[model samples]
Target: MIPSVPTLHSERFRLRPLVRDDARALFPTLGDPQQCLYLTRPAFGSEEELWGWLAEPGWNGRTWIAEDGEGEVVARVVAVPTDDPEVEEIGYITCAHRQGEGIARECTAALLAYLLGEEGKREVIAEVDAENIASIRLLDRLGFHRSALHIAFEETHKGVCDVAIYTLSRER
Candidate 1:
């Protein structure tokens, strides 16, 4: 059975499923232009936009939010299925001011452990803009291998660009 979204405890934060109430705490990081520079989609322009995004269905996967003890949102992670149920796609977004602080790594590790260990996923996938070096490095640190780059995968801060796909298998 699929497990219910559970609160995960990391050394510095508590990770829980993303909820609508998190909109205010997450906007600064999610809307920062510098942070969204290589994102596939444009930076959120308003709280309304962020809310719309947070409210959208996850395409059948889980979305987690990492918060400090004071309840400030520090990072976000998501693992959603692609066309194949055994393969899941993961996403991470750290607040702008919190970048370079290892928040993404902490949150993603927690999410992956649950998804691959308890959930029985065969692989975890991530598609990032080719110019997104930060994300590429994070995936590498997490043991993901480069799969392929799709031509003109999506429009981004650099205009239409190739998307690099990375994957990590359970056996690895």
Candidate 2:
């Protein structure tokens, strides 16, 4: 089981576990149809629903909220372990206003370090929509290699989408 992380730091951002109150700040980006298409998660029905999910307890992973120096949430990241014990899958989403600012890259680096160093993780995986060029590129930049593809893993507002799997090991 992945333990709850207190708070992680990067050059320009701080990441902490998502909480019930974050719903309002996160609604605009996470609820946007354009942004929700790539994420497997559906747009929340209400802040109450978001609170429920936020407060739900699970052993798989923890979702983190990235905040700037002023403590305003700027993005979100998740690190969930697959059935494989030593392998963990990670996903990241940047707030609409913060896209293309390398926030994903920076936050992911911190996650990797914590996972590999502090969490004793051996491998990290990422699943992205086949058509999400930017995410594919981001995974590549982070040293993840394409590993497999899942056909029709989920349906999105755009249509049924294929899931592209990528992997990164502790050593390279």
Give per-model CA RMSD.
2.0, 1.8
lDDT of 2 at 152: 87
Show model 2 residue runs off by greater than 4 Å.
Answer: none
**Tens digits of per-residue lDDT for model 2, 24-117:** 8877876677777776677777777767766676546788899999988888888887887788889888888889899999999888889888
lDDT of each: 0.84, 0.85
Off by over 4 Å in 1: 1-3, 57-59
Stretch of 10 with least lDDT, candidate 2: 51-60
Instruction: Give per-residue lDDT, candidate 1, residue 115.
Output: 81
Instruction: Report the CA-based lDDT of candidate 2 relative to the real structure.
Output: 0.85
Clash list (residue pairs), candidate 1: none
After TM-score superposition, what is the CA distance of residue 63 in candidate 1 from its true location, in Å? 1.4
lDDT of 1 by residue, 115-149 (tens): 89888889999988888888999999999999998
Cα displacement (Å) at residue 118, model 2: 1.6
